[model samples]
Structures are given as C-alpha cells and as structure tokens.
Target: MSSSSPSLARAPHHDGSVTYLGPVPTRPGGSVRLRVHVPAPGASRVRVRWGQDGEPRLRDLTPTPAFDGQWWTGELPLVNARTSYRFLIEGPDGARHRWLTAEGVSEREVSDRSDFVLDASDAAPDWVADQVAYQIFPDRFARSAAAADRELPDWAVPQAWDEPVVAAGGPVARQLYGGDLDGIAEHLDHLVDLGVTTLYLTPVFEGRSNHRYDAVSFDRVDPVLGGDDAYRRLIDAAHARGLRVLGDLTTNHTGSGHEWFRAAAADPTGVEAGFYLFDDQGYHCWLGHPSLPTLDYRGRELRERMYGRADSVVARWVDAGLDGWRIDVANMTGRQGGVDLTREVARGVREAMTRVNADTWLLAEHFFDASADLVGDGWHGVMDYAGASMPLWWWLAAPGARPHATVPLPIDPLPARDVVATMREVHARYPWAAVTASTVHLDSHDTARFRTLAGGGEHGGVDDGSSDSGLARARHLLGAGLQLTLPGVPALFAGDELGLTATTGEHARTPIPWDARETWDAATLDAYRELVALRREHPALRRGGLRWLSAGVDHLTFVREHPAGRVLVHAVRPRPDGAAPRDGEVRLPAAVLGGDAADAVTLRGEGLVRLDDGDEPVLALPGSVGAHLWLLPGDDLAWT
Candidate 1:
C-alpha cells in the first residue's frame, strides 16, 4: 500500500461523462473532498470512485439543477498516506484523459514532473548571510605542480600556463592558464585573508575544455583538474578553514560528447531519443550552438533519471557533503508551457539536499526577466547581475563614454540615473524574501574586466591610461559599498580588491597576482579591505532594508538599518566639480541620544569633528571623494 500504487474505482455515468477518484488515504477514516473544474457547461452526469489498492469501490455523483461550468466539490472518506489515485475525464465520443491526485496538479495536461513546494521552515542557513563568495574559473586561476606528475589522459592535453588553448580553429587567442582545484586549494589562505567565507567553483564536472560549462558527466569530477578524490579533499580543506563550497550545476544543456546526446544523435528511436531534442538538422542546440545540446524533460524516464527520483545524480552530490548548487541557464528549463520542469528540478534538488542538510541553498543563474519564475516557489536565490553589476557599469562607465551610442561611442550621463532607479525599483518589487539574499557580483568569467569596461589605456591616469584609475577605483568601491549595504549577499570577484585591469578575455579570468606588489594599488586595496571590515562588523549592512534618501546628478545617498540598533549611511559623489549638499540625514524614531550636548561621529572623510551643540552632526567632504559615516551617542574612539 505505497503512495504511488493506489486502488482504482469506476462509477456509473450518463451523457457520456465519467469521473474517477483516488485510492483513499490508508491512515484512518477521515473525511476528504474531490474537486473538479468543468470548462464547458452542459446536461451531463458525473461518476465518483474511491477504494484501496486491492479493493475498488464506486459511487454516482448526480449533477444538480444549479450546476455551473466552474468548480464541483464532493466529500468522501479518507484513509492514510499509503494511497494513490487519479481522475478519468470522459468527454463526448469516448474522449478520455487521466489526472493525478495532487494539490496543484494540472488538469489541462499531465507530466512526469511536479511543482516545487516551499515552506518558511525550510529557509536556508543563517550563516549564509555572513558569507563573502569568490568565484573561480578553474582553467584560468592557477596550474597545479602536481599535474605534471600524473599520467596524461586521452581526452585532455597537457598545456603550459603560457600556451594558448587549441581548438578546431587556428591557435585560439584565449590562453589556458591551467588553473585547477589543487591550485585553488593551495591558495585558500589568500582567499581567507581577503575576507572570503564561501568559494564557488565553476563546473568541475568531467568535461573536455577549459570552461566546464558543457558537462559530460554529473557523477565524476574532471580528471584533468584532479578527479573525485581531489574535489573531496578540497571541500574538506575549505570547510576546515571555515569556508563553504558551492559547485556549479548545469541542467539546461550538456556537452555534445555526453552519453545521452551521443546516443540520441546516433539513433532517432533509441532509448536516449527523448533525452534531448534531435532531428535531421543536427541536435537541438541552444542559441544555435553545436557544442552544447539542450536537455528535454518531456520524457518520463528522462525526468526520473535526471531530477524526479530521490538518490538521483543531484541527490548523490548533496549527500557527498557539497554545500549547495548554482543552477546554470535556469530560465530555459521549462519554456514550453507544460509542467514547469525547472520547478520540478528545484524541488527534487531541495528534497535530496534537505535529507542531507536542511539548510542547503539552491541558487539559479537566470540571464534576464526571470523574476516571476525564480522568486515565488522556484529557487532559494539567483545570481544577481541585473541588480548590482549592470547598475555599476551604467553608473561608472556610461557617464563618460557612450559605448553603445555612435560609431566610436559617446558617453551619456543621462542613463546613469535611470540605471540606479531601476536597480532600486527592482529590489523594491522583489523584496528580501524574493530578491534580497541573491548573490551580487561586479565581474565574472563571462564578462570583460571591470577596469577595461571603464575605458582601458586611452588616456594617462591610473595604470598608464586616461581612464582615471583612482576615480574608477572609487566608483568600484562605491558599487561594492552599495552591494554590501543592500539586502542581497555581496559577492566579490577575485583580484577586484587590488584593482586588476584586463585587456582581453584571458586577462578577465587570470589568476590573482598575489606576488605582484607593483601591479597592486595599495590605496584601492585598503579602501576595499576597510569596506569589507565595515560590512562584517555591522549587521545592518549585511541584511537590512534599503531606504533611498536622495539621488542627484552627481550625488547619491541611502540608508540601511536593521531591526537592531545598528544603522549605516552611504553617500557617493560622482562629479569632481559638482558641490552637492548632503541634505539627506538619517534620524532615529526613538531618541537614542542622551542629554549630552556633544556628539562624536566616525566619518570616511579627512579630520575628526566633535560637535558641542546641534540638532544634527554635519561632516564636510574633502574634495570630490565619497564618504561613509557612523554615528554613535557618546565619545568612543574605536573605529572599525
């Protein structure tokens, strides 16, 4: 008497209509109701059935004179959890369809997948709030000295760090720096020193190329980057150092070399035929990319194999002590209007992870306009690019250079305000429960380096360029400050602390030059380190409600306050000649200030001030630089 195997019962019907009901609950004799929605209204008879797996029972449900074309409800006796049932819809001319017994089951169609159900009790771990994530692109980070000792595999070629990656095309320009997990493990101390509490490794699953986005196997780690044992040891070491590890999970597509794709491509009618969408026009590729083939969740066996059944591939990884999953291309999972396959996958992943660790998080990578599908009941969080990085570029680079306007591009300062407004609006529309905890980042392996985007080497300023490195660093710091102070979890790309600039693709994913003191801008690094320390010290900066105080042509100010007595004020000055008054002031509703006429504040600007008597303490800005202020009641010299 399992839940999946339920008893079936049939009932008498007239006007060519019949309704079949469940294998009643086996626990007890509680009352249950059967509800149905009829689209077309007509003179019809309804039949209801209920029973256990072995024994079947039948009953007739007569249509009342006041019957409408909408919903119909009936009460019946319930048993226990060991019951499964379905409804048989009978239309005119012997047309029939079967419907499963579930709360949110779809009547129009029946699929092998189920929707995700979320509970507040199933919230992600509390420690996740304090985590500072650093994403690593394994192939470009660092090369392992141990790789030379190991036997070379057939699928991969041993390339030196200086060698360019070889593909079918002549001499691929993007160089392979040979960065691996062992390399990352060797440099854990560097990350720890930079205040990183979580490390998100790009797909380490066995694959052919440097970027492992096109996964070939979900069960084994890539041998070239040190296989399963290497990953296990890396996770162990990371955990020992108080760092959480999240592995990237690619579900939307697989490599052309994957077993399922190969099998399906060889034979159209094979067992793996439904695993991917394939026809004469090559395999069904995403965005016309032949190397990566999209997965099809329509097949019952495929769904069960990939995401439906417990102890599946996804569950097995969670059981292996992996902290969480970062889903790739989440928006394309269930595009066809059947049952949302993405939700189903999320549910299965969550259920399996919950079995191992209830607080496990599920983060999705959705490119654009995925708020509706991702927020309500789909994923725990998403890779937040729109709310952070996009706004940052718009604010920093869009002001001076119109990269998208003319032939050479003209910088438009008008869009800068719109970008900030949009970010604030998006955050407001999708509050903390939906959007706040999202991972906010500036640059990753996919995009150009932040410095390069800010105008690289055109004029002489910072790093022999007219881009003004100091101003760029200030804007970058301002962006980081905004991200850390906002509701979402702030993520920093490696080497961003030292103001690393990129000239090309390889430069964007290059290793952190820890030994290159000459390349590092000490002042910029200090600013970032101070910001990180400030965020770590203040609980309000990590998880708080953001209230926009004011926004102008050259100045932006905001306040972040938590439920506790912590409050932080952030103000940015974008123009050198613009002397905008810092009119916005944060005042607590409750009087935390005593009768002491003097007030002491720690401001980010030069010099210290002690106010004797005033309604509000004012700090003057030094030139065009930005400032952060912390107000305390009494005289305390301890500055964070």
Candidate 2:
C-alpha cells in the first residue's frame, strides 16, 4: 500500500471509547489485559492477535463485550516481560470487509509489525518526561565580570567575550573564552525566567582543550573552569533554584595528557598496560588520533575504575548531586575491531549510577540509529539527532551562507510527507519508552545554530527569508510550536532564543550575549517563552503518542494524545510567490481528538484558532505562516 493510504474509511470510523494505549505490565508471569472499542454498534466478534517480542507466529484470542457493550476485552498469557499485540474487530455493523488493528480500520491488511508492544521493564526516570532542558557549552555560555580569562593554555587562542569563534581558526576546539560554572550559577535567574528546569553542561572535567572530550583526569573538574569547589557550589545553587544539572562523560577514549596513558606509555609492562590496546607500531588511539587513546573495557581494572566500582566516576558524580550524564561518542565506546562490549559497559555504568540515585538519567551522543543501545537495559535514550532533529532541520531551517552547506546529509528542504514518514520510521524502531525519554533537539554544540540557518540570522540572499525579521521570526516560531507539542524532553540550546547567528559548528559555540542582550529581539524571545510555557502547562504535549492528521507539501497537522487529552498542532509555510494562501480550514477525525460532537474542544491560543468538534472536526486557521493549537478533554489526568 502507498504511504499516503487513507488511515480511516469514508464511513464513520469504528473507534471505541476504550483506549488501547496505556501501561500494559501486570507483574511477572501474569496475563496482560487488552481492550478495543467496538464503536460500530451491534458489533459481536472481536479477535486479538499477538506475538512475543519479534516473533513471527501470533496466537489468536477471542474477547467478549462488557456491560456497557462498547468494548471487547481479552487476556494473553505472559510470555516475556516484553511483547506486542493487535486487535482484529470483525462482524461490524457495516463498511470494511477485512478488520481493524492498531492503525485503525483498513481495507488492506496492516502488518502485525505495527502492533502495540508491551514492555514491563521499559521504564525511565519519571522526571525525564516533564523536563525542558537547556544545552550549554561550558566555555562559551558566560564569563564573570571580575574574572580575567586572558591567561589561557599555550594550545588555545583566547578571544574577547563578544567575538565569534570562527570555524577557520588556528585552534578551533582549544579556544576558550572562560565561561565557568560560577557564571552559570550567577545566571540562575535567567534560566528560571526561561522556564528551563534541566541544564545539560558539555564536559567540564580536566582536559587539554576547551571542548573537553579529551579528559586528562576522571576525578577532578578543570581548574580553568573554577575547579572542584566551584562545581559543588554551582550544583548546590542550581538545585536551590529547582534546576537539575547533567554532566557529560566520554567513555570512548582518554587524552594524551591523562595520567593513565602517560604512565602506560612509559612502561609497557606496567599495571595499566593492559588497560589499553598497544601494538608494536604505537598506541591504539580512537580513529588513529594519537592525542586520544581508546580504553579496553575487556580489562577488569579499567571497567572497575571507570564505572563498575562504587567509587568510580559514574557512581561518584551521580551521588554528588548531579542529575545524570550524557555519554560522548557512545557508539564507538566498548567496541573496537569486533570487540563489542558497549552493552556491558553501559549496563555497568547504569548499575553504578543506580546505586547512588535511581532517578539518574543516562543518555548517549549517538549520530546514528541507537535503538540497539536503548532496549530497556542501558542508556535511557540518546540526543535523538538522527531520529528527528537532523532531518527536521534539513527540511525546516533555511540553508544558510556556510561554505560546505552541502554535507553528506540532505540539506535541501524535504516535503511534509517525507518529514512525517522519516520521523515515523525512526520512531517505530524503538520501544515507546525510549522514544519519550530521548532529547528532541534542533541543534547542539556539534552542529550549526538553528537560528542562524532558519531564523534568518545568516542573511545569505534576499529570497533567503532572513532579511525580513518578522517573517523569519514567525517561521522560527512555527518550528518551536511544533517541537513543543512533540514527545521527549524539549531541549533548547543556549542563545537560541536570543536569535544568535552562526554559520558553522565552531561559530555556533560563540559566547552568549549577556553583555549586549538589550539589542536582542523581544518578539522572538516572547515566542520561545510562550512555547515553553505551553509545553509546561499540558501533560499531553510532554508525553503523548503522535497521531498524524495530515501531511501536505507545505504543512503538517497532527494531534498528540495522552491519557490527559489531545493537543492539535498545525503548521504551514508561507504562501508561495504569486500563489494564493491555503484554505484556512482543516477537518480531522472526531475519534482521534476524543469528541464526536462539535464544540467538544475548548481552544486556548495566542492567535485565532477556531475548533468545531463535529463527527469530522474542522479547525479554522487564519494565517498561512501561523500555527494553531487546540485541546479537547480526555479520560487521563488533567495535568501531570
């Protein structure tokens, strides 16, 4: 069948009032209860087909209607802690000849692969779903007014507070403007005002460079960034203001200046010799980079010192008031030339962290598919760039004035269908638990700033859309509105709301404009504030299952439904040159939004958005370059 196949039949969809989405675990070895609504009145037979995790064979079971006679319930004997199932509603009053499954009533048979999965063990920290995180680059976020940061390492090139870190520089990563933890603590009020409850600081450990992927030690914070005492004070202050701080760790390799590596290199027969893979040629570094050497997790001593032991790095920081960690280059860690111990290492780290704080969230910096690492055993989730952010950026953000704008990944704008299909395909591969816990980000320290590319910060050409500040802000706001309605912790990079400009990754790491913030656009900041508050106000927006209503070439309309309620988000690009704007009305299926009659939904928005929840609900939108949101009452909690 086509990807654009009609999800529902022309006749009234046989949507039962009963929900198929919820917690499915019923304890070990206990039967899993499942139900589906037989919305078609007088429907008699409803059969359930299910299979164990990834199993091809599905056992069939029959269900009987309850006293209300609207839903059919069944129980499947537990096979494992995780499995999937689908409903086959037959003997309906009318319409489809085949049956109904999780994807809705269909004339064509739907693949059982799309069946709803139940994993009792799939759980992450509850606080993860409710968080709105701010990503901060330690060396560029802020600097103290009194602190003189001019005295820097010989390898680094120091710059003024307001200067941009040009991509074509003498030493890119090593350049430091000296933003410290104490500075972050000083600006706690800024974060609280922006409604950022979670703070993600890129590595702050002792290292040769500013980026700090190359850690020189495991036990101490960098003295350049105010050292151990400064870190402790910063965490305490952040916590006092109700902010959770997350640290960054690199398990893949160690800096050349690290004590372990220097000692191992001096004597091959030393105790730490076995900790790394050393050949006759030289050291076994990460990707042939001599400055960084990969650790061999096969060594019991290395594993114990890094994560497995109670006093190890993972356990120490998590217990020391840190909320969690973001593992750097996690895909390459614990794997070298067929030696794969990624799971073992991650599980060890997770166990160590769990000993201190069970709520500790462990995420990974994976540039590719990481479903294998997120299978309910290791990391809670990843940065999620590959799954959603990168592709969405390619489609939504304007291609800016960067030299090599055409990287391997698609930079050309993709149609709305392609965007929707890509997200769905990536999401289907992961368990829903991992999906919601992942960091849904637009851009980070490793990528070009989104505002520079999309918000018109990089004025490439007149038609580029950055020249018109109002148009650019509105377009950027649409993206923010759509992202806030998505599941996962809404991750916002620092200075993004300030309309910062940067054409490349190095440039994106430019310092926050604390000294000259008065020049920033107030409208853009208000848009961001409102979007963050909107997500905070609704539980459905934070952790809802996406149900796409329509995907046009220039527009995306979807409903996010949680037990609490449904949030309708619709976004459309501006009208093309000499072309008329789209019709200001969109009709959605009544059942998808939890209402069968018009006026069932009560809308609250910043602009015009009218809702009529009839059998086929219609939303009257007013502008081409605008996003309209509406909410309908649901059986779930009013708010989490």
Candidate 3:
C-alpha cells in the first residue's frame, strides 16, 4: 500500500458484478436474474435487451418488492440460440443503456460480438472449477527404481538419470530419462503435500518420442514407461491418495509408425486409407510435418475408432480408470484448411466420456484464443494460454519473450491497465464454470520456462532475463500469487515450485533433481506450498466472484469473493525508472464491505480483518517487489 489513508470509493455498480448480473451461467430455456446497480438505490424503470447476433427483444424490469436494494432486476428466459444481452436503465434524467461486456461497462452500442456471451450447450465438470492441476511430463519427472530396471527401447538414447537433456526433434527427442507412471505414483505424497487435486500427465501412450505427441498406438501405455498395468496401478494409487490423473491424447494426427498409418500408406484402398487425407497428390499431415499424418474425420471408421464407440480408444482408457483425457493440439483437430468438424469430434469425445464416467473431465490444449471451441459445449476446460498466461508475459516478461511464449507473442511490454482489460475480455466469453475450470499455468513443456523469461536469458532465440536473480525470484513469487489468486485451475509445471531455471523449455524439462535439494530455492517452494494451501483451504478462493478492486501503474489489487469467504491478492512490479517507488494505497470496494470507505466496515471482529466495526482496513504498501494475501469471511459479505 502506498498510504494507509482512506480514499473515496469508485462507483462499483454495473461493472461485471453479480449485483448487476445475477444467477450467472445462464442456460437455454432457463430464466436469469438481470440486475443493474446505480448511484441511487431505485430507478423508475429498467429494461433488458437480449437476443441473437442480429435481432434483439426487450422486456421491462419490475422492482422486486421483497428486500429493496440498489440492484433493479428483470427475470427473463434464454432461448436455444446463443445469447447476447445489455441493459437499458430509466432514471430521472432520461434513457441510457448499460452494456456489460468482458471489457466492463459501455454506454454506446457494442457489437454483438462483444456482448456478454452465453453458450448453454457448454458446461464443464462442476468439480473442476474448484480444483488445482499439477502438470507432469512423464519422460522427465522422476524414475522409480522399478522403471530404471527396465530395458531401453532401440529408438531411445539412454542417458544417466541426472544428465541434462538435449533438445531436438529426431534422435534427441527419442532420448529417455526413464521417468514413468510408477515414479508419479511414488510421488503422490509430494503432490498431496502441495495441495494438488489433479495430476495431469503429458502423453503416456505407446510412443517413441520423449514428448509423445507421435504415438504408435492409443490403447497401450508404452511398455518402456511400465505399460498398461503400470497406468492402472498409478491411477489406483493416485485415487487412493485422493488425486485424479488425466492422460494426454492426440486426435489431430498419429505418428507415421502407427499401424493404421503404415497400413494406409502401403494400401491406399485399404480400410484404414480413408483415415488419412490421402489423394492423388498425397496425404495431409499436421503442419505439413510428414511423420504426423492428420486424421480425416470424413472417415466415420476413424471417428468410431477414436471416440465414437463405447469400445473406442477414449472409452478404453476411461474404463481403465484414468479420470480424463487432455486433447493434444486441439486447435488443429478436425481442422484442415477451411474444412472443420472440431466440435463434432470434440462432442463425440465428451459423449464417450459421459458413457464411461459422467464426472470425467475433457480439456483441450490450444495456445491461441480457444473461445471458438471452449464455448462450453465439448471441452470441460482448456489449457488457457490465451486467456491468462500470455497476457501476463506481455506485462511481466521482457518485450522479446517470444518464440518462447505459446501465443500472442510478447513483442512489447503491455500497460498494466491493458493487461487487466485483456484478461477480462478473455474471461467474459465463457460461463462462470468454464472461466473457473480453465487451466492456468506459468510455463509448460511447449514453451520456455517462466523463470527463464524472468531471468531474461537470450539462450536459443529467447531474449528475456532482464532482471538479476534476486529480483527475478521475487517476480516469480508474485506470479505464483497472481496465478493462484486469479481464476482457473492453477497448475504448476512440475519443477516450477522448486524455482527451476532453464534456457528453454527442453532445459526446463530437466529430470527432477531429487538429489539436489541443497541447490533448490527452498523459499520459493515454501511460498508455492502456501499459495496452493491457500487455494485448497478456502472454497471461495478456489471458486469465486472476482472484482478488480484497485489498479494502478505499478500496483494491482483484486478481491475474490467466494461462498466460503473472500480473499484479497495484491501484487506489484518493479519501477522502470532506477529509483524507489513511492508507497501506494489500495482502496477496497465499498460494495465488498457493504458500505462506503468512511462507513463503519461490516464483519467487525470477524473474518481476517481484526479492526472494530468503525475502522475500514486499507492496504499500505512498502516497496515494488511484494505480494500480499488475506482471507475474509464471506457470509457477512454484502454490497449495501
């Protein structure tokens, strides 16, 4: 906080608050409570204009006589089509409108594209919204002695357990450090200690490549990784420890070595030939990569083999006790050139999962804007790179942190205000369920490690590392605070909690150095543990309503209101100038305390605030490098 002095509150009404839009996650044929808050408690009349892309219908709102409040409401039913809505309020002055978009309030007309979007066809597993995910790359995590005792495949280049990994697509990609299912099973305790509820593994099916996107088969777990039985054992063990394991699946394509592909190549007229986009010119492969032949959904036979049937590959794994499937390259699946059936394929998978386990999650991996597919229809959630991580990089990482970031390449530093707005835009497109269930991460196997970006190392085309180790470490902790405090199923890329540093993602994938505890950043790990515990312990923090309570040039503060309680997260960035930043003050929203800043704050002698009823708590800041968290009682939370 810059100062402890109280400041007048900004009017918080009609700005993405439930007070303005109630009973969120609007569904088809269901009524939603649309309310608008104003400076004054009551208005003469309020109208809601809702419709499809080009047409809109209006309904007059009647004030609820029950418990009179500032929020004027209209209850209306949504139809079968995609819904878009805005409010028209009638106050003493005249008629004015309120456009509630992901970008917050706008009086002028916003394109139907920007209107609040609701896809009732889309709904994620309710359980995922409140859980955190822990990502593990099976090839480089930890190798149990049992896995180490196995023979190496001819295609794999064996290396010592502690050796650094080489990054390349051919033989280098084929190298193995021997981490396997048993190793993850052995480490369930560590994940549990970190308060993780989900164990998300990279590809583990029969495959030769270290990343395993090039799978030879879908039904069997690679024997080198302890095969099918090991997968079951891992699943059973993970379940015993109250953790769920989701395996990776590549529906976009299959390796050249896959039996169907090999057979199809030899006999174009064979039963499997239709699986590939084969023609007189040749077959189509993902990104024109010859080894990864794109699967053709035109072939019902292929769709049935993959996800359509109860006996399909998807069902086999779900029945094998795996909790879910993480669709690899989901952006490319069922999409080639202008042709697309991505939703059909995805919906097929969702139906298959429903057959096996109604609670099973279905996540898609897309570095770009996945809103086209994430509209709540098929995918339970997404590895939400576009929505969260990339925007963060644009703000926190160096301008040149590209080729290293997954999408929306970081070419320049984004203003703090722009970052918050972009996040709101991405978040507003989905229903509350998908928004909360989306997976948010700092770095993963597909990109350079986040710490590397913080270190600003230029190793391998990456131009990051603009700060010294000490300051970089603090920023990383702040990143953790933001990731955990913001929405999404917060995920850790295996070694991130240990303050792992790397030049590139490949280096970041270095085998977990179990023997190098003396060299680890213990403080970073402890902070991560605390943040995860914070998420685990509070239901509100896990799944809550978010409001940007305060934002400034060098500082940001937000409140997450949940049913269990409300929590505040504040983070700061180093000043660009080579001078100390002045102290900052963050004024909590009056709506949060159910009164104005000067009004005696509610929840006195309750929640995390220790002040008496008359004292309003204000955040006082010290320096630039800081992150703070506080929990407050939610039941007493009200916007008066």
Please tell me which model should have the higher lDDT, number 1 or number 3: 3
After superposition, which runs of candidate 1 have C-alpha atoms over 4 Å from their true positions? 1-121, 150-174, 336-340, 398-411, 414-417, 456-468, 503-507, 514-517, 576-600, 606-623, 631-640
Tens-place lDDT per residue, model 3, 69-154, is: 45556675667546766666565466454554555656677766655655666466667876788999998888888876788877
Where does the lowest 10-residue lDDT sum fall in candidate 3? 600-609
**Steric clash count of candidate 3:** 13
Query: Looking at candidate 1, what is the lDDT of residue 218?
Result: 81
Sorted by TM-score (best first), the order is 3, 2, 1
List per-prediction Cα lDDT, in the order shown.
0.56, 0.69, 0.70
Per-residue C-alpha lDDT of model 2 across residues 1-640, encoded as one tens digit per residue = 0111134212112211123444545344666555554433435465666675546443444444322234555566556766666656555656455555434455577775455555556367878888999999888888865347435667677777766576656778777788988888899898999988999999889899888888889899988788888899989999999999999999999998888898898988997887788988887888788888999999898998998788999999887889999899898899989899998888888888888998888888887778667654688788887777865775576644231242465356667768876776666556677777788886778777666556565531111223555555655666677667777788888877777656677777878778676766676678778888888987778876666667666667776765677677777765424244343344443444445324344443434333555454443443356667777666631221
Model 1 TM-score, all chains together: 0.71
* Candidate 1 lDDT, 1-640, residue by residue in tens: 0010001101111100011122233235564444443433322434444455445454444433221232334555445322233334445344454342221223476431221111222345667777778888887666678866665545555566534333224433234455667878998987777777888888988765667777788878887788888888889999999989888887888888887778887888897888887667766677778888888887877767665567566677777778888888877765443546777666666666676677677778864544565533357777777666666666665255422211134444433346656674454334244454478876666655565555543211124222455556565666666665666677776766666655343445555554555766667667667777777776656654344433444445444534332343544545533444333232221122221213434645433233334553333322234656554332211111
Deviation of model 2 at 570, angstroms? 1.2
lDDT (Cα) of model 1 = 0.56
- Candidate 2 off by > 4 Å: 1-19, 24-28, 35-47, 53-73, 76-78, 87-116, 149-151, 399-410, 459-469, 575-584, 596-623, 636-640
How high is each candidate's TM-score? 0.71, 0.87, 0.89
Q: Which portions of model 3 show Cα errors greater than 4 Å?
A: 1-27, 34-44, 52-54, 62-69, 90-96, 168-171, 403-411, 456-467, 576-578, 581-583, 588-624, 636-640
Q: Which candidate gets the maximum lDDT versus the true structure?
A: 3
Model 2: lowest-lDDT 10 consecutive positions: 9-18
Error of 1 at 556 (Å): 1.6
Give the candidate order by descending lDDT: 3, 2, 1
